[model samples]
Each structure stands twice: as structure tokens, then as C-alpha cells.
Target: MANYLLKRGNLWWVQRKFPVDVKDQLGTFFRKSLSTEDADAARLAVPQRMREFDALIGQVRMARDEGDLFANADEQPALDQMLVRYQGQVLSGLSNAAQRRHLRVLEAFGAFVGLNLTAQQLASRAKPVVEQWLLPSFGHTDAGRRALNVLIAFYDWVVECGYAQPPNAFSGYRIRPIKSVVVSRKAWTDNECELVLTSLLAEAERPANVLARDNAWRLAWVVLLGLSSGDTLHFVCEAQRQTHFKALSADWHKTRACWPEIDPYWVPGLSPGGPDGRRSWQLQKALGRRLTSLPGSLTYTGLRHAAANQVRPDFDAWLARLQAIDLSPAQA
Candidate 1:
């Protein structure tokens, strides 16, 4: 149904069905590249010219001898492959991330922080809306800003993979710069930690809200074990379980912990919970399931701040101990 195609090398070719009147214009485009053959030309000159122009002159000559493009086209299947990979692989990959993973993280964050979004419809629109409709309204103070940084990293990955154009759709935006605050702070005070743990335990005991209740109680886990370095909720959930499964979210948040040789996440419950291992391993059990959202509280990043301040021996010594680390006060 198309009138013409600029086959691989940018030369335009008219379809066999093109009208006689339209062929004059098409002929102007096709014949412009033609040149008189020179006796002095090397053997490679003809093929090189053909490759540069992407002309189907041989097929045209054959058509004169017989019929059109030999009644078949060669470049069509290759173009179909390009279109298929672009949609099925690249676009599907990015859209799935925005839908299942990015949207869920945004929801969990908004719920915990008592915030709302511009509208889901706005997020579904073009690039410009992210800042106007999405980012500014998220209320990303220091910790929230860092979380936004993680999303920015995802957009960067999309560009690097060539799914996006150069320069990235989400680049150049800034968040709260959590670094300056991290060093002077510690995760939580003894009282605050106790409050969180107790609140979580009580939450877990409730009959309904099983998911929220369980995660709230176990939220201090990696911090308790000195692993507060990261939390891609779903990946961390999967890593703790140590099994193979199709990832629900985009591949961006995956940790090396899933690959034990690289990731050093604390896999709790080599035995069970409690020092003696007789009590319930509720934290371990909750962590094993697929989480709809991560358990976070706007009040909780104070724990991270507190932990950073409490780092003894010095920042360098503390940095050396952790396998993975992020923003600190000096960098802020």
C-alpha cells in the first residue's frame, strides 16, 4: 500500500503499483544517483556504488526481461525484524518497567509519605510532564530525593541500551542531595528503633493487612544486620529467598545478591529467628514472598541518617566495611 521505500542505503524506490504520473517524480529521485560507467573504474567500484545507493537496478533490469523485482522483495523481512525488535523488545521492556515497577514504587512512596501524584494520566504522557506533573510534586526531601536518583539511573540505563535517544529523557534533574546529611546522622535512636520494631510487631499481629503488617515489622532487617545499603524492594525480596523466578519489575533494580558470587546480601534464617532458633522466623517468612510494594515510612529514613552519623572509626573505615554504599555528607 506504500508508494515508495528508501531501502537500506537511503535511495528511494517506487512500488510496482505506483501510477505513471507519480513515476516521473520517483524517477527524478532514483536517477539522480546514476552515473556513466567509466572504463577506468576498479572491479569494487560498481558494488560499492550499489551499496551506497541501495538501488535495485539489477532487479529493474530483470523486470524488463521478466517481471517486477522478480515478483518478491528482499529487504522487507529485515525491516520487519527491525520493527519487531523495536516494539516487542525495546518498547515493551521500558513500558513494563514504568508500569509494574516504577508505578508501584511511586505508589508505595506516596502512601508512606502522605503524598499524592499529579495524576496517573500525566505520568503516561510525554517526557515534559515528568518534571511538571511528577517530580516537583513528589515532595522529595533529602531521602525522597535519593529515591528519585534511583529512578534517574533507570532512565540512564534505557538510553545506554539505545531504547531511548541520546541525552536521556530524565537526565539533568536534581534531588535533595542526601549526602550532606548522611554523615551527621545515625539510623535511629534506641527509642525510635524500639518504637518501629514494636509498632511493626503489633502491625503483624493484625488479621487483615497481612502484607503491610509483615513488612512493617521486618523493615529494620538489613539495618539490623548492617545491610542498609540498598532496597529495590522486589529484588531484595527475591534475593533473600535465593530462588529462580521471573522478575515482576524491570531488570534495572536487580542486585548482585541474586548472583551470589557478586552480591553479598545477608540471607537470614540459615537456622531460624530468635537467638535460640525456637521462636517464629516471621521476618524471614515475610521476606520470601513477592511484595506488592516496599515497606517504608517517611519517618524511617531517619534511621539511615542516624546510622551514617554513628559510623565509628571514620567515614573511610565505614565505607570499607560495606559492600555497597551510596551518598554521604561530604558529597551532599
Candidate 2:
């Protein structure tokens, strides 16, 4: 049995008996029997809690000399070390996936900021330091959101698992980030596009500035096909009209405006410009013959821009193009 002493302000003192070695039960009994709405409770509770505190101090000194049962490898029974032991015992035995989240949060932030803090020290906690100071800037990004989610899930788990005797420090927290959209992406220049178009056309067209009517129309056809295939551009050209979702698929009605389940159809010896060699290449070749044109190569990406950019401008059009194919704008 241990006797607790009480005090009033800095002067009066009283004593009583408390019978436990546990920490919380003593603190609770100390707070309740001593604290009051009126001066009388403070007067009554102080001396009693102080007496209990003295008993606990004596018990601590005795235990420190008794044995190493409560000691760790370092032989220190500090609160930090003690909490770790409690965590290993209680947190390890708990099978709850959700509750483990809080333990993770405690492991992350509790060591430096939360645990072993004075009541005055809590006013300078780290959670708000990150949320109010750091997260305000980065919280909008994917990395920011992920970090906040990890901490929150852990905090929720901790409280749910009864790791704390009361509410956890993480509750009522919000992690909203600022919203902003990216408006631009890289696209090939018209001169660069002209070169790429040449590569996609017939072998005879590679060095020839003067393209036949069929080649010009073929290039135009291919360019339009690639561009409108993106989300931003909804319109389709003549060749694409047949395979375009509106004309080809019954599912387009149900799939909203999205790409749905379309797969790429790769074929050799075909330019995106047009399979039909029917028009306008003759005029291009004559123009090229009239004045030698600087040549450009048509790559897969270049052909895509040539086909699409005719309808939409660079950024939104590129974005739309990516969206139509179900690719992310971030990739663009």
C-alpha cells in the first residue's frame, strides 16, 4: 500500500492512501479527487495527488536498483524505452490491420513530437508544422496526398486499437491540397512535321519535294486520323469515319465519350496520311519542283501531331488526344 500526499497552491498539504503501481490509474485518481470547478476541489485534490506521486517516485527508485526485468538492453527504464516495449508487446499481438496504422504513425511522429511532451510543449506539435507549414505547398501533388493518407490511416488505426487511453492526436485533421491543371505539352514544329510526313509516305516521296496528289491527301488523312484519336478532338476524318467509335461500335453509346475497348491495328507499308493515293500529291510535287524544299522525317509521334494539330491547337488538343486514347495527361 502507498499513501498519496496533497497540496494547496504552494503551502497547505494533506496525505492519503493509494494502492496501485500502474501509471494511469494514479493520474486519473489524482486529477479527479483533486481538481474542481471551485477552489475547494483544487485545495482537496492537490495534496492527495502529490502524496500518490511521492509513492510512485519511491517505487521507481526501488525498481531501478532491484533487477533488470523492466530494463532494456541499455538498462534504462525511460519512458521512450518503456513505450517501445509496450508497443512491441501490445502492438505485435494485435492482429488488426486497421489498428496497426496508428502504431505506424506513432512510430513515425510520436518519438520526436508527441510522447514525453510537457503540457506546455504540446502547443508546438509537429503535425500542424507539416500540415500548416509544409503541406500547404506540396499537398496538391500525388506524393503529398499519399504521404498524408499514410499518416491518417495510421492515426485512425492507432486510436481504434486502444493504443492510447483517450483520443489520438491525429483526429479531425484534413489534408486538402490546392488544385491546378497542366496546360501544355511538347509537340513537333510544322517544319519537323513536314519531314515526318515524308518518312510515312512512299519511297519515291522521300527526297522529292514535289509530292503527288495521292501523297498529299494520304498525309492529310493520316494526320487527321492520329489527332482526332485523342480525347480533346472529337471530330473524325474521312478514312477514320468507318472505324470511328460512332460509326463502328454499339458500345460507344454506353461507354460515354471515352475510348472504350479499342485496340491498335498495326499494318505495314501504310501511311497514316491515307491508304488511297487518289489526290493532290501531283500538286505538292510540282510545288516542290518549283522550289526545292528542306526535308523533314515523319516519326510515329510526329505523324500523330500532323494528323491531329490541323483540327486543334497544341496544348488542349494534345491533352484531348491523350484522353481519347485513355492515356494520362501527365505522360504527355
Which candidate number maximizes lDDT?
A: 2
> lDDT tens string, model 1, 1-332?
12232233543332232222223223524422223343223232345544433444334323343533123433222222222222333333343334344445434434433332222222233254345435555555664465565446544544454444556545556656434444223345555544444444444445245445324433434333232433333334335433433342222123223222333233322334566453234544543332212233323345445555662223232223222322111222
Quickly count the clashes in candidate 1: 13
Residue 75 of model 2: what lDDT? 37
Task: Show the lowest summed lDDT stretch of 10 residues, model 1.
Answer: 323-332
> To one decimal, what is the Cα RMSD in angstroms of model 1 from the true structure?
22.1
TM-score of each: 0.22, 0.29
lDDT of 1 at 214: 29
Task: Write one digit per residue (lDDT tens) for candidate 2, span 1-332.
Answer: 12343446653344443322333234424332443345454565665567666677466445544546454443333334434444444443444453355445445555545466532243335466466643764566665665566555444544444443334454445556665532123344665543433433333233233233333333333343455454222132222323444442333222223323242321111323324452323433433342234343223344445445663434333223323332112222
Q: After superposing candidate 1, which stretches have Cα over 4 Å from the reference?
A: 1-51, 54-195, 204-223, 227-305, 311-332
Q: What is candidate 1's CA lDDT for residue 314?
A: 32
